[model samples]
Target: MAVPLLSVAAPAPHLIGDKAYDADSLRYWLAERQIKAVIPSTASRRTPYPLNRRIYRRRNVIERLFCRLKNWRRIATRYDRHASNYLARVALAATVAEWIK
Candidate 1:
């Protein structure tokens, strides 16, 4: 999704995935399409992978986002069986959460 989304845009995104996406294929794929990858290397990688230490430290924002989103009981339980309905609830929840913030 990231690849396709970035590919069709006027400017590409600088990818900032975690060490999980540090494989050769992922790096090569991003580089092949002119995307700047910021995935840090694992201890086992053959060489160090470059990363922006400042940006990487804020990775927990994703976790925090989910933690906030989960405060919506409907989303947490996934009571809406349909995908469309679920997405609507997610949007509604986001709007409400924004106001709360």
Candidate 2:
């Protein structure tokens, strides 16, 4: 599902994801695109791929940001009927989140 987005999305140096995305095929696919995968290897894998701990830690920040955004009842409930309105609300929420920080 995400592969289609990657195909059309602007090129990025890295692709960060969680354990759910830690598949050999996906890693190989990202390798072919020269995008470094920041996903950690699943525990069951025989040989775990080396991970950049620093980059992986950055995912936590994104997770926290989403948690904060979801705190807004309107954003969490998707009350906006239009995409533009929803985006505007998200932008407002993000600004408020940063301002409070």
Candidate 3:
């Protein structure tokens, strides 16, 4: 999923992800694209890769934003069946959340 999406997306300097994205292949893929992978290594790995804890910490904010967005019942339950409507509702919810913040 990440591979196809990234292939078409604009290049970025860094790719931030959790432990689930710590596969060697993905790391190599990102390195090939010159994008730094800020993913934390999984515990079972024999040699964990070095990570920039400071950069990885930023992912928490995005996670929290999604958590807040899910507070809207419509988005959490996926009430909008259409992709366009769902996107619009998400935008609206994000706007509202920001306004209330």
Candidate 4:
């Protein structure tokens, strides 16, 4: 999913994710692509890496955006079957939300 996005858009230097994305293979893959993973280690990890708290705080904005989007039933339920259509709806929702804000 991210690979296609990176191909279409400018490649990001850092990838921020929640602890659910904190897997060794994913981290290795991000490192191989020269992208820094800003994901915190899961509790079960033997050696937890230190995270920049300031940078991690920025993730809250993204989380809130998703929360707002989910408030729309069509998006939350994924009414669009096609990827393009789904993405379009998400873009529309985000634009409206930003405009209203």
Query: Candidate 3's C-alpha lDDT?
Result: 0.91
Q: Give a tens-digit lDDT track for model 3, residues 5-100.
A: 889999999999998888888989999999999998999999989999999899988898898898999999998889999999999999888778
Clash numbers, per candidate: 0, 0, 0, 0
Pairwise TM-score winner, candidates 1 and 4 = 4
By TM-score, the best candidate is 3
Using all chains and alpha carbons, the TM-scores for the candidates as numbered come to 0.72, 0.86, 0.91, 0.85
Candidate 1 lDDT tens digits, 1-101 = 55566567675467767777777877787888777787799899677977888777667766667788999888999999899999999988887776787
lDDT of 4 by residue, 1-101 (tens): 65555556666888888998887877787789898888899999999977878888999989989889988899999999999999999999999977776
TM-score of 4: 0.85
Where model 3 places Cα greater than 4 Å from the true spot, the runs are none
lDDT of each: 0.79, 0.91, 0.91, 0.85
Per-residue error at 31 for model 3, in Å? 1.0
Q: Which rank order by TM-score, best down to worst?
A: 3, 2, 4, 1
Q: How much is the lDDT of residue 13 in candidate 2?
A: 95
Could you tell me which residue pairs clash in candidate 3?
none
22-62 per-residue lDDT for model 2 (tens digits): 98888888899999999998989999999999888989888
